[model samples]
Target chain A: MTTTAHNPAVESHGHEHGHAEHHGPRGILNWLTSTDHKVIGLSYTITSVLMLVIGGALAEVIRGQLANPNGHLVTMAQYNELFTMHGSIMIYLFAGPFAFGALANIIVPIQIGAPDMAFPRLNALSYWLYLSGAITMLLGFFVTGGAANFGWVGYAPLSDAVYAPGAGADLWIGGLLLTGFSAIFTGVNICATVFYLRAPGLTLFRMPIFTWNLLVVSILILLAFPILTAGLVMLYADRHLGTHIYSVAGGGVPVLWQHIFWFWGHPEVYILALPFFGMVTEIIPVFSRKPVFGYKGMVFATLTIAALSLGVWAHHMFTTGVVLLPFFSIMSLLIAVPTGIKLFNWIGSMWRGQIWFSTAMLFAIGFVVTFLIGGLTGIYLASPPLDFFTHDTYFVVAHFHSVVMALVLGGMAGLYYWGPKITGYMLNERIGKVQFWLAFIGTQVFTIPQYIVGLNGMPRRMAVYPNDPEWQTLNTWSSVGAIMIGISTLLFVVNIVASWKKHPAGDNPWDGHTLEWFTTSPPPHHNFFRLPQIRSERPTWDHNHPEAKALAHGKEDH
Target chain B: MRIESKILLWLGIFFGLMCAVYWTWSLENAGGVMMFFAMGLCFLPGLYYFWWSRRMGYRPEDDPNATQETGAGYIDAFPGSSIFPFTLGSGAFFVVLSMVFGSWLLIPGLGLVIWAALGGIAEGRRGGDK
Candidate 1:
């Protein structure tokens, strides 16, 4: 092995001494107080997974109630709280944080060839703030009024003090404010690290797709989250201080809340999805044994998607009648082009390539197929005429579920793909594959019928429906599917535990293409023993194939 | 930056054209205003990156096998345990609780918040000397 005498910044921090000493901090106190990105990342992942279980439990309750017509699983009020908390917990607490907070914190530094985030202390702060927010949100359940019952959107007038006079909604507002601050902090950390950190020879274009996606996610967070934060403050004032931010009688239009909320809400959808898309982009190419096809196009398309995302907020408000429908509709349609380009590029990468059917690849393929369905259905909803019919219906539910499920599946794929790198233990492949199939099939079974019933004029957030046989039948099937999803999630936990001690994954478990793979499995505290010579976008590939420049240029295809 | 600028420049033009079309369709609506603003925002970043990249050419990040000197010798420094994060979290908790409970908690909550913020800045400066 050649050791290049490089700058002092590239020097390892006495890595040969051993892992324990150099990694810094130990015991329970260290976890609570440490600024190590890896520790913070693990903390974030654990918290998000716990929240996933809590949120998923809420979903089970919802499915149980909807299983039978006029079901008395709980009263209407409890039903409202359950569903509201379900959406809020899953979106705010689980998906967004899991993707950007956990995955990004763990992977971005290693992928970018940096030791840690730019502001490690701020990174720690972000995690603690997030945990605080999660606690506060859950605290709403113990309060007198129950958890926020105006749905997760907490649309105004309904959420007003007159209508919802209690500490529950106030708690919801407080929780979200903290979480928004956490997100903004994390966003700043990510942007700064990517801008300032990066190993030599890793240019903006040469960076891995996942890091690129995170960069865009950071920008979107910085720009979009403050709007939500401001809106929350205003709502809090309206409720507690008797101000009239959203009260129509007080000259404040209730619709103003929709404008502010969806401005953050729509981009919030992308904040969750882009990281998943980036993960899939990275996973597909590596398993297929090819460099990502059209790497530049992938980067360009991601940025374009992000830019267009800012302009499409009104698409969510089309049925509100206040939004200019044509503008939003056109922007929504245009946003699809970049997304379509990504799908094409993914297929192009897998084209004629030695595609592996690993658990990760299976989920990635599932994401592509599922997200395509989601995106296409979204096109129908983007049109004002069509949206008027389906808005707040199960069709819309099915559509967004498809989208969110794709994101969740993508996150799972990333976890499996990077499990070895993060934990030094390969997840049990057979069990992983089983979990993947169950989840995929279960999600489809659960959500597909939502579209059918929705088109049949079933509204969303409804506690009960008329005793119609067809609706009952569809709802029962959906509940069964939901059960399958629950069982699949349990299998995933079992796989993690069962494989915890088995199959010690070596450094390059999948012969990965990026810098992170060049290091030890569950990489050392300093990330690298000595950094590899980067020659192109595929640094590890270049290091391994020094004599095969032609292969690097794609002249000799696999 | 170079590649980013080119991509953004073209996207700006594309959105600019879209704005024209939307404007022609609806002259005095929120949609046109949004499209017009998008066009402007897109162009600003596009031009900035282009200008910045031209000024700083052939950087280490742009070339493979380049010496690692640019980003080397900089092991990330980790700070020891500090109380500010916990205190800040406590401040947030009490402040929120004050809203639900009463105005009495507000004084302590805001006081703790200010105390934590000042302590956090000073803590870092003190650590630098050590």
Candidate 2:
């Protein structure tokens, strides 16, 4: 079914077709000094996967400790360190890096039909900064007092020199600052790439949903992260440089820290979310056998969501009592409209089309359900009166899990969908289907009881709770659910591991629509030898089935 | 029309509109000012791209009638093999290390950083064959 113009069988040898620089040094040396986007992307991917393992192990320990009311598997202090490192690692290391650094690096240039990233060396530097920052953060566990335990938010006085009197706190600040810079640089590179380098017919509007979302997320990172950098610098000053920006004893407002942190932190939620949304959007269309229902609407919704995210930061500060209630509440609720628009487009894409329930498609569906649950709970928390009660409760815990589960589910879809393209092998879908069900059931099992105990007045971040039968029973069930999720994750790892030496997924395994599918399974040093004529977003789809080539040119909404 | 500018222009207006709405509704809070700042952040890049589009004119992709061949041939030079990123990363390692063990660590940290910076510039200017 391959097109005569862009045949994968012939052009698969394009690496040797005059691009002599493609045949560079082998193995480790190639990786070290190399500026290849694929190499850098794999660096980001492998590192984030390892960080996920570290964070997951910490979570299993946390679940074990909370299995019984009196279960003190680790001391209270060490427990703080566990959750703290876990939160930091997942956000900064696992989720953000995987979504932004790894996926963006590996896929963006290919989708846009570019030779490489705009600033290839700067792209390499971004990965290096991330690596150094990751090492710095992990190095904290071995230090005198273990990593920053003032919560991942690092809420002021708790993070001050008095309470967390350790070098770990300083290291945490330093590490985040480096990672922050890394994110900013990556953001710049993506923006520049989109602005400058598009293949002939790849106009801004013609670009894929994935590229649009990365562009918006990059802008968000550019604006949102520097605020964190400034706030962290001030906090560091209060700790070592003798300034009192957050110290109430020294007349510095403690609430100011909340304001600054959430300003960065709330947008950080959308930063984590929008890319995965893009991933689901990409997958839904492929499996459903249709173009996206509304391309312009998705792009506008993304822009609207990003703009609104900047103003709704104070929704997180409702419990602090100093925030503007109506302003933030209305803004936070308004954001739901744009997100709802995205949901409508996804459902419409699958509505009457030939929907296939592949492993990736199942995960995308799971993401929709989980994201809805998380978004609704977030809506409830936006109201100041309700948030006052549920601020630090297990309900919030459940809500956070739902949100992060959406990330996990969406990320799995991306991995399954793109893994063949990254490594030239097909992932076993039978194993994948089993893994998906396990994750789907396990997350709900873990999250549902958390909502129950939370609504029943159990506060979160608790090392140990009082010995009550209701709390004890629910805790045991939740731990059982957590173990199930761990097993599910382990199965995924095995599936990917087994995939290493199995059947070769030839180019266009899915008979896909994008430019990436036109190239070989794991494309050459330069991304594409030839791009299909981009009359519509689904160019490759048009080329493969010329009978429907005219039909593939979608009547996109103006 | 450079379509990149159109994309950013709309995004900038979205941010600016939100800033106006938020400011009018809640000027009493400090968040209004922050919204204004956010608007500026969007506009800076958006307007710069707009200006660039005006100056440099349409990209090959901007034309509906353009062929794929028009976009071919050396777009720009990308770095081939370079040792500077490793040097820069090592320099950053020591700089972060300085945060843990007194300020004495900046000696090696800043030194290596400076060395990498100068070396990268020289490598770029030399145009290969070091």
Candidates 1 onward: DockQ, in order = 0.35, 0.45
Candidate 2 lDDT by residue in tens digits, A243-352: 98899988899888887888889888998899899989999999998888888899989988987898888887787777679888998989999999999999988988
Q: Candidate 1 has which clashing residue pairs, if any? A: A8-B73, A9-B72, A9-B73, A9-B74, A10-B72, A10-B73
Name the regions of candidate 1 deviating beyond 4 angstroms. A1-23, A550-558, B1-59, B75-83, B126-130
Task: Give lDDT: candidate 2, residue A507.
Answer: 91
Candidate 1: Cα lDDT at A370: 89
Q: lDDT tens string, model 1, B1-130? A: 5765775577678668866876686553444555565567558867987898899776666666576656555343445455566667678777877877787988988988899899878877665212
C-alpha TM-scores of all predictions: 0.92, 0.95
lDDT of candidate 2 vs native? 0.83
Over 4 Å off, model 2: A1-17, A550-558, B20-30, B127-130
For candidate 1, write residues A402-515 as lDDT tens digits. Answer: 998888889889999988999998999999899999999989999888989999999999999989999999999999989988888888899989998789999888878888
Specify the highest-lDDT model's number: 2
Candidate number of the best TM-score: 2
Clash pairs for candidate 2: none
